[model samples]
Target: MCRRSSGYYAPTLAALALSATLGLAALSAPVAARWARTTSVAIGAGLLVLTAIPWWHGVTTKTPLREMPVHGNWALPGEYEKIGRKLGAAVEKAPVRSAGEVGALAYFCECQVVDKFSDRARLVERINDARERSWLYRLNYLMLDTDELERDRLKPDYWLDWRSGPNVGVGGWSTTGVYRGSGHFELRPDRPAHKPHPDDQGQLPSQASK
Candidate 1:
């Protein structure tokens, strides 16, 4: 929900780097148009190497790479699919609440993923409303990758623990957060789902929750 300046730095730096490289290459030759095209490719390759040099240090220092060492054909690998199936099956059979850093799992589990950017009060109200309605709910990435101060505002029935080690889950290098690694984790509901009494509560009964 919150936007930070660091997110913009990558593309900003990339554009500046490419422009400077191309500008320098253009000045060196009279054929500006031809050099611009050829030099841009070479310069871009060099920039990529220069930017990735830090990661290369990891190899020399024997630091772990931020990738799960799992083998699977899916976009996220089978481990995530398994986790999603577990969550989905549980939610389908019972009332359950879930949230995690990975958003795809909530979708796969057939539960509406709560928006992370919402105001804390509004978010909490929605979660509570869902509970009151006895609906299956999911709030992805509760205490991870978000402002830690909001942790106490709401309580989740289950937490998906995938933020740790080098991998942060299948997201790996593609994601940014306090931790990075693949998710090989488990989640269990803190309590059983209770059926909401819409008759007494004056709310519409949820067919999914039943």
Candidate 2:
């Protein structure tokens, strides 16, 4: 049996603790005004210190889902990369197929990333807005394609033959897929090929093809 520590709840709990402390302080203002200056200061200071304990614990134990590298070409904006890493991990664990599942996982991953910004209500609203716009669906598709391409799971020509037929696959396809435009045309052999030297073109040698 795995016992989950309350440490994971530190951030949210700390915020709530701070809010409650503030409310209490506000409510006590009238009563505190009647007390000695030293007494009021001490009580306020004590509450402040107590409120800080949870925040301290939260900061000290907070672990990022992914660590950003110090130097690399792949380095992305810190916040965006953090979101990407969390989304990537979720993608790996998912049983992928249709676009809908991908979008749902991506949204959850985005929520985790947004939680770091300390705005739960805003994050939830953002997720709902994105979902309604199908932004998550598009984002998921891009993520899926990018991951596959990086892993070499998807080939450049994967889409080239997709519309052709059921049996048509990227493999065994020609160097360039069949031309869809006007019929293929080759350079006419009759017209002398462009001469490399200017002098050669100016003075047509007898041996040069007429």
Candidate 3:
């Protein structure tokens, strides 16, 4: 289950700045002392209130956050959780590959989860892509975060193929095909060879798309 924000996690800098009100008021010209103190406290209060809205909404809405922008579709997150539990159960007492969706499966499956792309390597690669792009990508990334990504040579087996495509109707997501290795085969193995719908295409650009 996804946890709703209680706003306790929000930064309290504005609340902290409230402590400076008395000092700022005393240092100001006497005529403007009250004005400065009042304005400062009001602004800080406003920001604090603004930060509380998400928490209030969380208190109101019982809906679990559900979204999948990959294919512009919606789904209950439980669907994905179900798939994870199912996969874990299938490989009972053994380690299996995951899409690095989350840590819950790792705990439930009682196995070490490592499917590449989940660690610093992929982050470094994306940062490289950012360096070659506009400021938007570079905004939150630093080139010095890591040296060039050293490829992890550990080959994966029994890979999770939970991309958007044919849905087995188990979960809301399209078929989560467990392809051998990372071959990224596009055609649904259960179906005939044909171009997948534009939305169903989730293959990596470096690998075969169809």
Which candidate number maximizes TM-score? Answer: 3
| Model 3 lDDT tens row, 1-210 | 222223433456545665566667667798887788678778778876876785566556744444321221122334445645665566554434444344544554455444444344434554566557757556655545545455542333344444444544542234232222112212121322333322133433333354
Q: Write down the lDDT that model 2 would get.
A: 0.34
Better of 1 and 3 by TM-score: 3
Q: Model 2, 1-210: lDDT tens per residue?
A: 011234555688667656655755566666664454555466667767876886576566755423221222111233334433444454443322211112222343442211112222323333334445676544644433333333532111111111222223322111111222112111111322432312212211221365
lDDT of each residue in 102-181, candidate 1, tens digit only: 44455456653332332243244444566555534434323333234366434444544332334444322222232333
* Model 2 regions more than 4 Å off: 1-5, 32-133, 139-151, 154-210
Candidate 1 lDDT (Cα, 0 to 1): 0.45
Models sorted by lDDT, best on top: 3, 1, 2
Give residue 84's error in model 3 in angstroms.
Answer: 2.6
Candidate 3 or 2, higher TM-score: 3
Clashes of 1: 13
Error of 2 at 109 (Å): 26
Q: Provide TM-scores for the models.
A: 0.36, 0.22, 0.46
